[model samples]
Target: MSLSEVTARMAKAADQAGRSMDDLSLIAVSKVQPNERVASVLDEGHRIFGENKVQEAAAKWPMFRETYENIELHLIGPLQTNKARQAMHLAQAIHTVDRLKLATTIARLAQELGSCPDLFVQVNTGEEPQKSGILPTEADEFIAEVRELDLPLVGLMCIPPVDEEPSLHFALLAKIAARNGLQGLSMGMSGDFERAIALGATHIRVGSAIFGERDYG
Candidate 1:
């Protein structure tokens, strides 16, 4: 799908969900995609992008940051403790914070640098042990821990098990956010975003549908 088609789909989904198109932000996941593909999306007026790895983002951000002043880079994957500074430097939002140690690292770095970006707690809605997220049962405590830090705790994020229906996971995340007084749900992706919108996803990360299959070597 092209960028226009992607936006149109988002518009349709938002409309069906009784939300204005402007109410949702489409974060184009750019992980593993080349800089040229990212530039193409940027040229099409998509200012917000999501990257899964700090190393990939670090390697790609400088290539475009100087040209796209309004670009908003979001880290949408597992963040390592040692990479907190690099993530803070390149990301406007970090979406995979699942533990206090990682949060503390980010908080410390943000304080030292005099900059704190938006932060989101990742929940393992599917209870997948292999995934990098706090267990759903531990979400409140995790949020409470991170809240004490001086970062802007904007919301919750999750990636459902690929085999199961995603709506359940999205709804669960939305409920968790509501219970915690968080208004953002960074759920959904290229495959199930429309359903996520219907279930109250405030942000959807889309990639393949817009940029085609990514070649990650």
Candidate 2:
């Protein structure tokens, strides 16, 4: 689907949900997509994008920013502590902060650099062992711990298990964020974004439908 179509759908979803389009951010997940494809979207005046890897974003966005303006980059994959500093510099927001160790590292980096990117604590709503998020049971304590570090925590993020219904997980994440006073819910993707918006997803990460399927080969 094209960018205009995606925005129109987002508008419809928000209207149906009684939410304003201003409250929603469309993060074009540009991981592994061709430069031409990404550039095409930029040419269409899309300013916000998401990248799965810090290095890929660093390599791509700087060149694009030279030509375009106000490009917002978000890191939406597992963040390595070793690369935390680089990720902070490259992206406007980081959406996979799941561990106290990593959060502590980011806290220290924020002190050293005198600035930090907006952070979203990733929650493993499905309790999937292989997933990179703090368990639901541990979310409250973790959010408190992150707050103590003053890491610019802005919201929460989750990826529902692909085999199950997504609205349940989105609702779960929204519940957690609501109790904690977090306004940002970074959920949803190409498939279930409309459902996510209905459940208060402030940011929807759409990839394949926006840039076409990624060529990982």
Best-matching candidate per TM-score: 2
Query: Where does candidate 2 have its weakest 10-residue lDDT segment?
Result: 52-61
Best by lDDT: 2
lDDT of 1 by residue, 1-217 (tens): 9789988988998888889887788999988887788889998888999998999898888878888878899999999999999899989999999888999998888889998889999999999989999999999988988988867999999999999999999989998899999988899998998999999988899999999998966
lDDT of 2 by residue, 57-119 (tens): 889999999999899999999988999999988889999999999999999999999999999
In model 1, which runs have C-alpha deviations exceeding 4 angstroms?
none
> Clash number for every model?
0, 0
Per-prediction TM-score: 0.97, 0.99
lDDT of each: 0.91, 0.95
Lowest lDDT block of 10, candidate 1: 62-71
